[model samples]
Target: MRIVWFRQDLRCQDHPALSEAAQKGEVLPLYILNDTHPGKWVMGEASRLWLHHSLKALSDSFNGHLAFYKGDPLNILPQLIKETGAEGVYWNRCYEPWAITRDKKLKEHLKKEGLDVQSFNGSLLWEPWETTKGDGTPYKVFTPFYKTSCLKGEPPRTPLPKPTLTCAPLPPSSLTLNAIDLLPKKPWGKEVFSGWEPGEAGAEKRWEIFLKEGLKGYKVGRDLPAQAHVSRLSPHLHFGEISPHQLWADVSKIEEGHDTNHFLSELGWREFSHNLLYHFPSLPEKNLQEKFDRFQWKKDPKLLKAWQTGHTGYPFVDAGMRELYATGYMHNRMRMVVGSFLVKNLLLHWHEGEAWFWDCLFDADLANNSASWQWIGGCGADAAPYFRIFNPITQGEKFDPQGDYTRKYVPELAKLSDKYLFRPWEAPEEILEQAGIVLGKDYPLPIVDLKASREEALAAFERIKEK
Candidate 1:
């Protein structure tokens, strides 16, 4: 008998570990929720909510055969093995630091007990160690790493077909999904997940929608937050509801074009992030470029709170934050805008922005989240130059020229004209009165002056420049 463990790789389609285990013999599919995370990166509130529904979807696919348990795998796995008298355990790999440590110990202990153990790369299109610089060293920049990632022969063996399996009966005393309580205690989940369907079917539906409609103009529209051009695939991908290989295969079959090339390049960014995290485990906390250590970051809780709650007075940044708080997802361009605001405009630490996203984003990921924040923080490999500050006003006018995105989330600014929508502070007092927006009364004033803050941020950057 074999017990197949489901970690991030949630779906049965294109699952190598699930395939291998089913071919072996009777398979018991398991998803375990440990009391604690592999590290302090606990599943965020949004993630917990998403996990609950995704697990339900996975369970339904198995016809109520998927098992849920909350405890240390050290305690849970052995019981599962004993319950089924399973001689082998299988799972896909998780590359986070804590998962690495735990998996290492578990594999050794299981092998010593005379049980066969196997793991596969069911998540990534390429393993972290698969691509490297000519010197066999890890890459610090994206362009070189992206090129090296593509040269590795044909794409990942056409994502394996969904293998059939015989569901084994639970031994006994199995916990129900609700018993694990992955959902938040309040009623907040209903709204947070209203726009999403969290499961394999949902993931596929989203992909189809993207391919049919969104993919055509993705390059131009992806940056525009108001449109539906972007595939809301990050949460699904993070949870492994869909395999990267499946995405790659479907995309590969499409005739090459700017849309195809640009989208695939984004996938390469995903690969780059996993590679970055594997080599630099401290990515979530430390600066990749050490000089950032000398940079002075602020600790103003009020500023942090204002930024977190979407009252920074920058329409683009506020809209992104409100979108995130509303849907647990934010547009990619907006993520950078908000990130730059926090780390640069507010002079807060990147980790502060990183930690906030960790708690709020439905797609809160270890590799992507950490690497992305560090990249914006200007302390990551191939990071943005510290001087390349993103002016929210220009960004809004360029990407959301009609002010549609700002109005969508920051509805208070809805009645303002496109000319003054992004810069409400610059709106003549008559316009504010006409729009029913009494600046300091209806919406808080700008938390900090952009001109002064930009200067201060530049001075801070200059202090660390010589280092």
Candidate 2:
């Protein structure tokens, strides 16, 4: 018998692992929820909730033969192999540093046990090392990275199909969704649970909807936090509920010329993230260049609290934070804007913001979240320059002209005019009173002046270059 060990690849559709397992022998589909690396890096509460639904959905697809375990997979898989007499193991690839290490150890252990082990690329459309610069080094900046990756010949024209036979019809196994402690016991999960429906079917439905209606205007409308123009498939893609190939396939079919081409290149950005993670294993944690280590950062607890609680008094930043808290997602543009406000405006450590997102976002991907945080902090590959501080008020006006997104999330300031939405501190005292907002009580005033903060950040950044 062969074992199909499911990691992030939660779906059966386009899963090369299942096909390979079936080819080997009766597949014992498995998923191991190893918290052994406690603090090693686990999914947030929101992500755990999504995983529960996604796994339940995958099990539903199968006739309940899939097995799940809670502890170390290295320990559990060996026991399972001995019990089921499995001939081999097959699974998909993951580019996260921890995952790469885990897979390597598992493969080596399994190989020593005299069993066959195999893996395939499913999480990303292209491997990180594939589209390097001519010197064979990974692309550090995004524009050139995107260009090189996009210019490379397209992904395989045809995607792999679901395995014809997941396993030679096996007797029911003793695994259910509740057996894992992934679900929350209390009432707080209600909001997050309500926001998502996990599994391949839901992912496909989301992609289909995006491809049909959202892709055409994705370039123009993706920046607007108020609309659903951007594909809301991050969690699915992150969890491997849907393969990157499946997403790429749908976009590639769009006959709308430049729009279609642009969409495909955006998909390449996701690949670019994975590639960077693979090559720079310390990525997301370490700066791509080392001089950033000397950059001065504040450990201001009050500022950190304000930033985390959406009380920064920067309307757009607060709105994005609240939106992230309410829904387990945020628009890509706001991610940069809010990240800049925290790192650049507040002068807090990038890791602090990365940790907050780690706790909040349902789609808290290791590579994307870490890379994005570092990028915004002006400390990592293709990062926004340190001098380029986001004027939160102007960014809000430009990206959310109508301030609809902010109003929806920050209802206390909803009645405030669009002009005052971005900068409540600058509003007249009467206007603030009429809006029932005290600079510090009803809503906090800007914690720091933007102009002063920008200059402080830029001057401090100069030290790094001087060294």
Candidate 3:
């Protein structure tokens, strides 16, 4: 019997390791929750909640034969092997630094014991090592990386079909899904995850809906937070409920155009982030551009709390944070806006934003979270310029012109007109009263003057530039 280990790749369809194992002989599906090795990068509360439902769906697909264990894989895998007499182990690759180190050691140890141990690339379209520059160094910029290397290099392998499975009986020692304790004890857990369907079936259905309704006007409409142009597939992709290969192959069949090309490029960006993390293992902790190490960052607990609780006084920024808290998700445009406000306007460290997102976002990914925060901080490869601060007022007016997205999250400002929705402090007292709103009480006054904060952030950037 072969042991097919499930990690981020949760779905049975198009699973390389699972298909290969199933083709060989009876397969024992195993999931090990290794919290200790990941340290600070362990799966956050939102991710755990999603996993709880996802695991239940997967186990149901296997007819309750799936096995679950919680501990270091080094100890648990060997014990399972000895007990089940499994001759081989197979798993898909994970790109995290800790996971890479752990898997390498496990594979070598397993091989030494005369067992077949193999890992397949089931996540990324192009492996990080496969898409390097002619000099064999990783690409630091994304445009050339995608256009010159990735697009021009060997295409992603065709997705595998699910193999017919002959299952081994569940090991008696396998723990129940609830025993893993992935769900929170609080009432908010159910409320936050109410609309999300976290499973393989849900993922497939979402993709189908996106293909029909969302993909047509995706390029321009994707920028509008209120619009339903986006696929909302990040959490599914993060959990590997759907494969990039499947998405790419299916989309490639469509008539090539701006919408299709732009959508594909977004996937390319996901690849770019992973490439950065794989090449620079310290990506989550350090600045890629060394000069940013000397950048002065502020520490203000009150301001941080205001930002976190969606009381930041910048409606656009507050709206994004509120959406994230309410739904465990935020629009991509809003992610940049809120990120810029924290790292630039507030002069807080990017790590603060990264940590908050790690805890709050359902789709939070280590590589993307780290890289995107660094981009906002103007400290990573091909990062946004430090001087380019996103004006919350203009951003809101531009993207959410009708106030649909802002009002949905920051509903206290619902009665306010579009003219003052993004900047209520500038509204006349009569106008505020007409809307049944008081600036400081009903919504909030701008916490910091945008002009002053922009200048301060620019001056701070200059200090590091001079150094």
Candidate 4:
């Protein structure tokens, strides 16, 4: 019997490991909720909720043959091996640093124990080390990295039809979902559960909708927070509930025409991020550019709290933060705006903001999250130059011209006209009074002087550059 240890690659369809394991022998499907790295920020609550739903969905599809385990895999798998007398183990790869270390040790130990072990590239369209410059070094900048990846075309095809028979008798599993403790005791999951449906089927449906309807308008409307033109598939993608190769294949079916290149490039950006993470394992914590270490960053708890709670008083910033709090996902444009507000307006460490996003975002991926935060803070590979500080009000006016999304999330400014919604502080005293808007009380006053803050942040960047 073979053990198919499911990690990030959660689904069976288009899963190379699942296909290979099934072909070799009877397979025992397993998902271990190992929390050994709990203090290392194991995974966010929103992601755990999504995983629960996705696992439930997979269980349903496999007729409850899927088994759940908890604690360290190296310890648990050996015990299972003895119990089932399984001959070998198979799994897809995870690129996170901890996962990489864990897999290395596990594979070596299993090999010594005389068990067959194998892994496949299931998450990304290309492995991180696969594409490099002439010197065989990974591409540091996204544009060139994207160009090279595009030239490589899609990943080699490895489609697996759904299994026709049950994989072993589930090994008389001693494990249960409650043992994993993935669910919270409180009601925090209520909102997340109601909003997001997690599972392979849900992910497939989302992909189909995106390719058929959203991809065409993605370039133009992806920036509009009010519209659902974006895929909103990040959580699924992040958790390995879906694969980039599968998504690339499906999207490729659309001929190379209007917006097709735009959509594919965005997916390519995701691929590049994974590639970055694979090459630089410290991506979640280290600044890609070492010079950024000299830059002075604020450690203001009050400002961070205000930013976290969405009371920053800057309407655009507040709206974006509140949108993230209310929903685990934020629009891509709003993500940029909110990140700029945190790093530039508050002058806090980009790492600080990155840590917070790591806690809150359902799609808090190591590559995209870390790379994007550094990009906004002007300390990443191929980053926006340090001088480009986003004007919150102007950003709101440009991306959210209608203020419809702001009205929905930041209801304190609801009664105010869209014209002043982005900059409510500019409204006359009488107008503010009529809207029940006590600027400092109901909503926050702008936390920092936008122009002054921008200059200060720029000066700080200059200091780092000089160093």
On lDDT, the leading prediction is: 3
Ranking by lDDT: 3, 1, 4, 2
Q: Rate the local accuracy (lDDT) of all candidates.
A: 0.89, 0.81, 0.92, 0.82
Write model 4 residue lDDT over 1-467, tens digit each, in one string. 88888877778787878888888878888899988853476777766767777788887877888888888997999999999999999999988878888899999999999999999888877777777776888887888888765556455465557665547777766576656777756576677544566888888888888777788788889988998789999988887778777777777677787577787788888877777788887777778889987878889999999999898888888888888877888899998888888888788988888887887788888788987888888888788887887888998899888888888889989988877898888999999988889888888788889989988888888788786
> Model 2: per-residue lDDT, tens digit, 1-467?
78888888899888988877777657877888877763446777778878888888888788777787788877777887877778788998877777778889999999998998999877777666677888988887878887665565455436788886745344244355688889866555676656467899989888888887887777778888888788888989888888878777776666757667777777777777777778887876788768889989999999999888888889899998888877888888888888999889889999998888887787888888877888888888877888888888999999999989988888899878887889887799899888887778878888899989989898899988999
Better of 3 and 4 by TM-score: 3
Worst 10 residues of 4 by lDDT: 151-160
| Candidate 2 pairs with clashing backbones | 128-275
Query: How good is model 2 by TM-score?
Result: 0.95
lDDT of 3 by residue, 173-235 (tens): 899998877886666567887668888998999999999999999999999999999999999
**Which TM-score value belongs to model 3?**
0.99
Ranking by TM-score: 3, 1, 4, 2
How many steric overlaps are in each model, in order? 0, 1, 0, 0
CA RMSD of each candidate after superposition = 1.1, 2.1, 0.8, 1.6
Residue range 245-322, candidate 1, lDDT tens digits: 999899989999998888988989998999999999998888998999888898999999999999988888899999
lDDT of 2: 0.81
Number of the top TM-score candidate: 3
Please list the residue runs of candidate 1 whose C-alpha ends up more than 4 Å from where it truly belongs after superposition: 152-154
Assess the local accuracy of residue 13 in candidate 3 as a C-alpha lDDT between 0 and 100.
Answer: 85
